[model samples]
Target: MTKKVLAAVKTDVETIEIREFDYPTVKPESGILRIEASGVGGSDPELYRKAGHVPVIMGHENVGTIEEVGEVAAKRWGVKSGDRVALHEYLPCWNCEWCMKGDFRLCMEVDFFNVKDRLNTDRFGMSTANKPPHLWGGYAQYMHLPLNTVMHKIPQDMPATHATLAVPFGNGVQWACLDGGAGPGKTVLVWGPGQQGLGCVLAAKAAGSYTVILAGMTRDQSRLDLSLRLGADYAINVETQDLEAEVMRITKGRGVDVVVDTTGDPKGEIVKQSIALAAKGAYLSLNGLEQQVPIGEIKKRYLTVRAPRGRSYAAVELALRYIGSGRYPIDQVCSHTFGLAQVHDAILATAGRGVQGAIHVCVEPWK
Candidate 1:
């Protein structure tokens, strides 16, 4: 009997349904992966709540072993059967200028959000299971790996949960250091103490920023404390104390040299606050959606404003190496894990609506 694959499909607003699909054929220049762990990303909560989209398998941060790979595909990826690897979501057309420059983030082929009929796209995690070869997401027993899929080799003995964190760390390094210009002698301020914000803390510190301050609400004291343990120099409660006053005090009234907000709020309050706390030549990178902030303040302050998302190839490599080096107690960050059957609970916890204090959550398929 042909085997069937199991996946947790996001069927509606804040809903998940376990479904089955036929195992896909392994054509030349393609492969199949036996997924071990899939980290629930910061974006997962928002995506889970979004409506009017096709039922796509929804976990994007995937780490698995190569169950099978076509001859050409194995050769091209320098990976063989049974090898552990981390799968990147990008399916870039290699011939494009962006791909040639190794900036797959800018490749138009994988820009699912802007493209028309985006629900019918091929980008992993967002692809609909409406068609054949439906194993496009990581919340499944197996996944289909196309030829253009970007992958990184993971060491044999690394824990699947720990290895799965490379994606968020990649985003951290990209947003904090590469784009936000955090480096030696700079005082950096990050808004939020969640996994992504803590990631920015580690990245900023690793980049040699002189000071790293993490801000969260009064209710996030636990997470704020975790940020300090994870390498943040200071943790401030924006709700209990004045955010701008506390930031200025921490920076000795010089304002922050680099600022990053991971809260993903649609309102402009955080963005405006970031502007108010920036140094004369500071850099600001916010993950929030479009907000009406005063552009004049940015111009007056000579602050460089950037909105960064996704990870770079180099950043991914650096993050994996960092995780493997055993430099930080990364296991503490993997605060929650659930079996495939409990994907809904995991999402709820990560969304902060169910379980209290879920730092980083993962779905272990065989758990």
Candidate 2:
């Protein structure tokens, strides 16, 4: 049978291509589910622009249904061939020291989307594209997920649509709240009220942060408002207000206890202002992939920086629990959904920058 999928062939280009390829015959090498619906994420923009290299199949976040199972994987996850699940983007090398230590995120040898073929050669496991079509991408009609990378089972009662944000939202939860030590008395300054930043806001609040400040441009008003509703103590428009000064004033000149930047544009003056507004010993967590951080200034300020690689299945599961608990409106975050063919429109909407919450571009592959 032939597999149909879309691929970014060159810098600034996309095309739907078809090829004779094997479908995933095994769902459980470790415990994997055939993807039902894969969601697009911000990291995709870099691939779309070919910022690093050419011919990249650029999607990571996804949710799916189990089509097949390996005996070992089935025993471990307790999932059958028909269960729903979530996929963790980072594929770790199980033989690595980090994997042995249970710190799969730190695995030196990691396989992302396009590079899957280098690790697995089994049928329907992970393959490379020597030509135009790449089945490794989630844009395909069917996705081949290797056992080592899949994580989390979506409960039958939960909506598969909301579960799509499990990865990105988990990122926000892990960085700002869990790793940053957000608690009853700490003040958190979350820069950029986009999906990730808003996730931080929700996580900080869930973790009992005393003060949550969302900093963003005037165009981000929609997200800022949603942040306030989610749990932000204050929303500061950096374009219309002095962000640093406002944060200082909010903290009574003590500065926020922690600063989280998800804007991905660190060299920008606004990010510098966030640095200036942070307490001398404050913690700084960066989630934006596009920004280059100023290490020198961070050193001068004695900032305690914690960089998280990506959300694991465990972290994503935790976020799902928090969402399921009814404390915050996780379901409200997905402001949009679209069919696979509508991906261009979805990207345009997200890139336009007025989304009130997490702007998810959903793909209904079966549709």
Candidate 3:
């Protein structure tokens, strides 16, 4: 085994430096993972541009193989050498009530927003690399998996590239199926054709929604087409067509039963549009962090508004099953791949800046 590991460290706003670190000694309660693929989400650009924690290794969605596992960790995690797995970013204290209830995503210990100290909240890709072990994130050749790290075994037949879809697919299952209440006999409107929005389209279709409509700008023509191929009933180019009118025309003025906005629209324009397009007593699942919503409009419409956080244990399990089923062309969603040295361009690709027609970008640390 190599004595050192290589990683892409974000030293400042919009800056990435490839650095090397000594391989961490394996502890009886911990393990080391050889990263295969690290997914780049829409949020990655913001994390790169915003100066929060300096010199952080930022790649949260990670899939890798177990290179070294301590005896205790092996028994507790039920894994051994050479086993492929998808790692969850959250590192919650197992003793917390949220962890006990299997909602570890809500645990305050790993809640970076609520917690002040960077060391206390150990979120993969967000935590500072200044701490010991030095390889906390997936934009590296290896990642240090602590005792409390959450992971799921990947089926031997599934390719690592396909397994990389777990996180986004899980979010789709969480926001669309679980939070938006998309199912049989329901009409769903997903207000973004990004990777997350496309995931929602798949989840809604799998859940047997009567109609799944995906909305996007003209720049997302390729993504919208892909969404249709994945079972979305309509893909509206909101920039060209009248969004509300087109939606009403499709549903015969009844409006959609569920509206899921993953646009992350800064001005909350899409959110307001989602509220207006929703039917009476409809469910609205939003993933945007900062958005101004009209409370009076929500109350008058009797809408059930839900802000979906990260995926739960059940959601990830379901997403894995869906990915393993060969059901939809989920693998097609991962549109681009970059080597560790191209980490800057990789994040830019996800933001639709550098790469043309890029959707879901993956960073191959070893490449």
Candidate 4:
């Protein structure tokens, strides 16, 4: 029997068509899972807006329960059908040079949400690494996980909806804790107080940063409040207040040791402010390019501007472990929950205002 699923089609400029398609009827592979809740990403805003491209599956962050599994995969991953798991975006070529060094994220044949295959066109742009064609992305009713990729079993006690936030939160931990060297006695500035920005605040605090100064807009008052609750030492309203002055005041003129730019606004003023707030040797980690940087300051200050590479599955797993440990509250990042049908509205909500404290956007898998 053919199952039914939703497909994100570009209907027009700044619009998406959520039409249903026949789902994959193939059986599950050994040790693999059929995911449930897949998380949406901030990077996908352009895709939704049809700015660059239009009409793709349009989901990356996700978690789900194992619906069925092949015998071999079940034994190998210690995951059986019905086991809850969070999906990693990358499906690495395990034997590749990078994967050999345990850098799976750098694999040349990596598939981000199984969108494309770098090797053969024989599959009609579908990835045939280790899973069947039916299992591809989580935007639909089913997604496939190759045996070699990093798919961890989340704690049974944690809801998959909450677990869906892991990818974004893991991004926070990876960018702030592991990449930016955020930890004890260090100060970090988190620019853009959206879900990802607030996540940076929480991750830096959890990583033991001396202080986390948040620079956001006056409209982000709710996010600022949430940041304070999540452990921000200071939250600066960049809209009304002077950003440079606030950063200087918070750091006592020395500037923060690190700055995390989760907002991809290239021309957005917050990015420039973030650059100015970085100390000479400070690590400025831009998760993605939102806006262009001023070359003058970059040349003069000797700033180490870098973009975050793929996260350590192990590091992300550790972040998930931290979430399970009850020490740092992961649920604090989620702001709301909605069924799969409400996806368009969810996207609109994210575009409207900041999902302060990580709004839990839930997608109930078809039972």
- On the 0 to 100 scale, the lDDT of residue 264 in model 4 is 68
Ranking by TM-score: 1, 3, 2, 4
CA lDDT for candidate 3: 0.88
lDDT of 4 by residue, 1-367 (tens): 6766554444455465556665444344444345566665665455566543433444667777777776666766787778888867776667878889987776766634334532231111123322334345555566655565467788878866667767777877878888888999899988777766766787889878998988777777777877898789998887788878877887789998888877765566656666777887788886544567677888788777787664768767876776676765556556666555656655666665444333445545452
- The C-alpha local distance difference test score for the whole of candidate 2 amounts to 0.66
Q: Write the per-residue lDDT of candidate 3 for residues 63-172, one digit (tens) a residue.
A: 99999999999999999999999988999898989999989999998887798776447789888898889899999999999999999999877877677778888888
Model 2, runs deviating above 4 Å: 1-21, 27-32, 51-57, 111-134, 287-301, 353-358
Q: Could you give candidate 2's per-residue lDDT for residues 176-197 as a string of tens digits? A: 8767887799999988877778
- RMSD (CA, Å), candidate 2 to true, equals 4.3
Question: CA lDDT, every prediction?
Answer: 0.87, 0.66, 0.88, 0.66
Q: Quickly count the clashes in candidate 4.
A: 27
* TM-score of candidate 1 to 2 decimals: 0.97
lDDT score for residue 2 of model 2:
52
Candidate 1 clashes between residue pairs 3 or more apart in a chain or in different chains:
none
Q: Report the error of model 2 at residue 187, Å.
A: 0.3
Worst 10 residues of 2 by lDDT: 119-128
lDDT (0-100) at residue 29 of candidate 3?
97
